[model samples]
Target chain A: MAYSGFRLIREALTGHKGWKPAWRDPEPQAHYDVVVVGGGGHGLATAHYLAKNFGKTRIAVLEKGWIGGGNVGRNTTIIRSNYLLPGNEPFYELSLQLWEGLEQDLNYNAMVSQRGIMNLFHTDAQRDAFRRRGNSMILHGSDAELLDREGVKREAPFLNFDNARFPIKGALMHRRGGTVRHDAVAWGYARSADRYGVDIIQNCEVTGFKIENGKIRGVETSRGTIGAEKVGVAVAGSSGKVMSYAGLRLPIESHVLQAFVSEGLKPMIPGVITFGAGHFYVSQSDKGGLVFGGDIDGYNTYAQRGNLPVVEDVCEGGMAIMPMIGRTRLLRMWGGIMDMSMDGSPIIDRTPIEGLYFNGGWCYGGFKATPASGLTFAHLLATGGPHATAEALRFDRFEKGLMIDEKGAGAQPNLH
Target chain B: MIIPHPLLGPRDAQEFVYLGDASLLDRPDWQHPEAGSAYYEYLYLRDNPAGVHRELWFHEQGDRSWLVVTRDTTTHEILSAELASQVALSKEPVR
Candidate 1:
C-alpha cells in the first residue's frame, strides 16, 4: 500500500510537481525520450537530427567530458568526399553536399572553406594511381582534376619544381575539398540541439549497459541509471570499451594522430596539399598558421603524447614544398586518439545486439563525414535498415569476405 | 644521367640529361665556384628514346646541393657527375 502510494506521488509529480532526479534532485526531474552516448560531433548531431527530423524531443546526450571533448575536437577538420569505394562513394558525397550548405543549415559560421586539396605525384606509377582515383571521383560526379607539371606549377608556384628530392611533377586536385573550424562545428551542434530541448549531460560517463531479456533497457552511468528503449554509442576513440559491455569486439586500432600548427604568417599555401610519397599534408589556416599532420604513432595507445620524429618528417615535407615557410615557428602540437579500422573506413550500422546501435570506426577521417554520418546512423537506427550507399559497410563484412577495399592494390589501413 | 635540383630539400628534384657517349665525366668534375660544392652522378636512358641519342642529368637533391650530371643518351649510363652550388636547399628552420 505504501509503495503504491509512492508510485502515485511519483507519477503525479513527474513534470507537474517538478519531481527531480537524484542527480538533479531537490531541483526537478529531467526525463528524456532517447539517450545518446558520447557528446562529440556525431552524438550531438544525432540528437539534433532526431529532434528536427522526427520531432523526438526529450533526448539526452551524455558525455564523459565537455562536449566535443573526444576526437571530434582534436581532428584536423578536413572536409571532403573523395572516397572511391562503391558504397562509401555516394554516402560521402552526401556529406560533401551537406558541408556545402552547413553554414545556412546550422545558422552558424563553420568556416566551410573550399580552398581545394591537392595530392602531389612523384612518379609515373603514382600519376597513374591518381588518374584512376580521379576517374573514380568523376564517375561519382565529384570534381577531380588531373594536373600535369605546368598545371601543378600554376597552382603552387612556390613549390620546388626543379628540385628533385620529392619533385613536384603533377597532382590530383579535388576542387570541393577544404576545411572547417572544428570547435565551431561542435559548439554549433550543441547549441542547436540544446535549443531543441535536448539535455547535454557533460561529465556523465556510461559505466555499463542495462540489458534485460536480451534487450537494452537503459544505461548504467556514473550519474545514475537512466531508462531508455534504445541506446546509440557514437564514441569514436573509446568506442571499443563502451561496446565491450555487450560482448562485442570491433576491428579497430586505437592510435594517436597528431597535428601541428606553425606561428601566424602571411597567406602562403593556397590549398591543402599532400605528398603522395611521404606521410605529410599541409594547409594554411585562416589565422595565417600553417596547419599540418602526418602518419599516426603507428602503435596502439590512448595517450595523446606525440613523438617528435613524425613531426620532423612532416615539417621536412612541408619545407620541400614551400621553402618560404622556414620563417614560420611552430605554435602548438596536439594528439587525438583515432579508432583506425583495417581498411581506413567507417562503420555506421546497427549492432547485432538488440536495441543497441553503433556509429564509429571513422579512422582518421571522421571530421569530414560528421553530418552524413549522423544522418545515416539515425536513419539506420530508426528503421533498422541500412542506406543503399552504406550497405557494403556492415559490421559483418569482415567475416563475410565482402570488404570494400578502395585503395585497389593496398586496402589495408597501415598501407594507407 | 640524373642530377639534383637544389633549393628543394634532401629529396626534391633531379634533372635527367641524355647525351651520346658515356665518356663525359672522364675529363674533370666542374665544381660550382659560387657555393663551393662538388658532387654529381651520370646514368643512361635505356628504352623509349624520344630524343636524338643519349642522356645527361643532375641530381640536386643529394647532400644539400644539386649535381650537374651527364649520362649516355641511348644506354642511359652515367657519364659524368659534377656538383652545382647554384641551388641551396634551405638554411631556415622548419617549424
Candidate 2:
C-alpha cells in the first residue's frame, strides 16, 4: 500500500494494524528480460530504475544472502559529489541530484540528510589543491565553498586547531554532501521494484551463467536454473568470482575496508569532517553515535574483517583531528570488501560477452553511487549504452590508458 | 595477524606493506609481441580468491625483506610464508 499522511492518520486511529510487509519475497520465475546478480544497494537500485525509468517490467534481482547484506549495509553511509576529476565529478553530481529527490520519488523514508561535508586541509599545498577542486565542482554546477580556519572554528570549535605538526588550515565544504540510511536505500528500492512487478529473490545464489554462442540464455543458481536474456552482475567484491563464470577477468581487486561506530552520546560533531593529512572521515549519526572510517586494510582479501593496525591507524587519525572521540568508547567495528578498481573509479559498461554486463570497481565509494549506478546500469541494459554522465566509466579506458584515476595512485588499488 | 618470516621469527603484521597478488612477480617482458594485453592483465586483473592464496608483503618497518605469504582470504589465516626472492628464483631459469 502507498504510504501517505492520510493513511498514517487512519492507521493510527485503527491501532496501526493496516501496515503490510515492505516488499514481497517472490520465487524465481522461469525467464526474465533482465537479471541482476547481487541484491545489494546497487542491484536493487538497478532493478528499481529498470522498472521506474526504463520501462522494463520483467526483471529479477537474485541475492545470495539478502538485500542490504553486503557493503551496502556496512559502509559509513556518507554521500558526496565533491570530486575533482571531470570524468568522476559530473557522474557523482548527478548522483547527488538523485539523492536530493530520492525520498519523494521512492515514497519511502531513506533518510537522506545533506548536512554537508567539510574536507579539511592542513597545509598550503593542500589548500591550493582544495581550491582547484572547488573550482572544478563549481564548473560542474555543484556547490562548493572554500572556508578559512575561522570558518571551521565557528562551526566545529572542538577540533585540535593548535596541533604542532598538522594544524587546521582550511577546508572545502560541500553543503549538499552528507549521509543516508544505507540499508533503507536497499529496502526502498526493493519495495519500489516489487510494487512494479520486479522479483526480489533472496537466498538465490547465481552459480553460473547460461551462455549459448555469444548471448546469455539465463543463469545457474543454487535454488534452480532461471533464464534471462541479459545479465548484469553488480556483486561488489565478488566481481572477480562472478565474472570468472563468464571466463572474463576484470581490472578489479577485492580488499577489506573497515568502518567504526562509537557508543551513543550527546550530539557532538556538526556534519562530516575528513582529515587532510590522514585517511579518516567522520560524521554523527541520528542516534548520536559518531560514525567514522579510514583507509582500507592494504591487502587483497575477501574476508569481511580487518586487522588491528588499520583500526589503530584510523583511531590515530581520529585523535589527530578531533581529540574528543578518543574519550568516546568505540562500540563496534566491521568490514566490507570493496571492488578496488585499478584507477579507483567505477565501471558501468557492457563486457565483450554479448549479453553479460558488469558494474563494480567502486573502490571505497560505492555507497554514494547507488542511485547513479542503478540508473546508469539500467540505461545501459535497456538502451545498450552508458548514460551520458557515465560514458567514461568503460572497460576499454584501461587499455586506452584513459583510466579515471582520481587519486593518481597509478595501479595501486589499496592506495586508492 | 602475525607473519612468520622465512628469515626472521614471527613478526607483527603492522611492520609490513602489502603489494597484491604474488602473481605480480611474473612481470611480463616489455618487448613481447602482445605486450599490450600482457601488461594489461599483469597490472589490472586479479584472481582475488576467497580461499588460500599467495600475496606479496614488504617488511617495510622490520627486516626490510619481501615475503610471499600464503593466506586464506576467507579467514585471514597465514598458511605459509617464504622469501619472495627464493620463490622468484625457483620459478625462473638461469640467465
Candidate 3:
C-alpha cells in the first residue's frame, strides 16, 4: 500500500490498522536472472538499483539470517564523504548525495540527518593534514569548513581543551555529515527492491558455487540448487569464506570491531565528533545515549566479540578527548566482524570468474558507503564494467602495485 | 586468550601485537622467474579459513620476540606459540 499523510490521518481517525509488513517473505526460486549473496544493506541496495536503474528483474537476495542482522544493524550509522584521495573522494561524495535524498527515494523514513560532523585536530601537523583533506573534499564538490580552536570550543564546549598532554587545535567540519537510522536503510531498500519484482529470501545460506570450467552457472545452497546468470557477493566479514566457495582467494581478513553506548543523558554532543589524537568518534543518539566506537580489535578473528585490551584502549582515547564521558555509566557493548582488506580500501569489480562480482573490503567504512556501494555494484553487474567513480576499487590494483592506500598503511589489515 | 609462551609461560594475549597469517614468514624470492605472480599471491591472497589458522604475533610489550601462533579463528583459542626465529631456522628455506 502506498503511504501518505492523508492515508495516515484517515487510518488514525478510523481505528488505525492499515500498516503492512515492509517486504514479502517469498520462498527461494529455482532460477533467477541474477542472485545477490547477502541481504545486508549493500546487497539490498544493489538489488534495488539493479531493478530501478538497469530495468533488470528476476533478482533474488539470499540471506543466511534475517535482514539487517549483520553489520547494517550494528554500525554507528554516521555517514560522511570527507575523503582525501582522488580514488575515494568523488565516490564517497556521491554517497553523501544519495543519503541526502534517500528518505524520499525509498518512500521510507530513513532519517538522513545533516546535523554535521567535526574532525578535531590536536597538533600543528594534524591541522595541516586536515586542511589538505578539507581542500580535497571541497575540490570534489563537498562542503568543508576549517574551524579554529575557538570555533571548535564554541560548538563543543565540553571538550578537554585545556588538557596538559593534548590540547585541541582546530577542526574540519562537514555540515552535511551526520547519522541515519541504520535499520531503516535495510528495510527501505528491501521494500523498494521488492516493489521492483526482486525477491528477498531470508534464512537461505549459500553453500557452494556450481561453476563449470570457468563460466558462471548457479549456486548450491542449503535450500536447493538455484540457477543464476550473474552473482554478486557482498558478505562483509564472510567475504573470504563465501568467495572461497568459488575457488577464489581474496586479500582480506576478518577482524572484530566493538561499539559502545552509555546511559541516557540530556543532549550534549551537537553531532558526530572524532578525536584526532586517537581512534575515537562519538555522537548522541535520538534516545540520548552516547554512541561511540574506536579501532578494530588488532587481530584476525571471525568471532563477534572483542577482548578487554581494545575496550580499555578505546575508552582511553575517548576520555582523552572528552573528559566528561568518563562519568557516564557504560550500558552496552557489542562487536561486529569487519572485512579488513590489504590496501585499506574497498574492492568493487568483477572477479576472475566469468560472471561473479565481488564488493567488500570496506574495513570500518561500509556503513557510510552503503548507497554508493549498492549503486556501483549494480552498475557493474548490469553493464559488465566498473562505474566511473568506483573504477579504482578493482582487485588487480594490489597485483599491479596500484593500491589506493588511504591510510598509507601498506598491506596491514589491522592497521588499515 | 592466554598464550603459553616458549620462554615465558602463560602470558596474557594483550601483551602481544597481532601481524596476521604465519605464511608471511615465507617471503617469496624477489628474483625468481615467477616472482610476479609469487609476490602477488604473497601480498594479497590467503587461505583465510574460519577454523584453524596459523598466524604471527609480535610480543611488542613483552620480550619483543615474534612467534608463529596456531589458533582457531572461530573460537580465538591459542593452540601453540613458537618463537618465529626458531621456526624459521627449522623449516626448509623457500627458493
Q: For this target, which candidate reaches the highest lDDT against the unseen true structure?
A: 3
Give me the TM-scores of chain B across the candidates: 0.29, 0.95, 0.96
For model 3 the local lDDT of residue A158 reads 92
Per-prediction TM-score: 0.74, 0.98, 0.98
The global C-alpha lDDT for each of the candidates, from Candidate 1 onward, is 0.70, 0.90, 0.91
Query: Order of all candidates by lDDT, from best down to worst?
Result: 3, 2, 1
Q: Measured against the native two-chain assembly using Cα atoms, what DockQ does each of the candidate structures obtain, in the order listed? A: 0.01, 0.82, 0.83
Candidate that would win on DockQ? 3
lDDT of 3 at A252: 88
If both were scored by DockQ, which would come out higher, candidate 1 or candidate 3? 3
Cα lDDT for residue A399, candidate 1: 54
Q: Candidate 2, clashing residue pairs?
A: none
- C-alpha displacement of A292 in model 2, angstroms? 0.6
**RMSD for each of the candidates:** 19.0, 1.5, 1.3
| Candidate 2 residue spans exceeding 4 A from truth | A410-416, B93-95
TM-score of 2: 0.98
- Candidate 3: residue A413 lDDT (0-100): 39
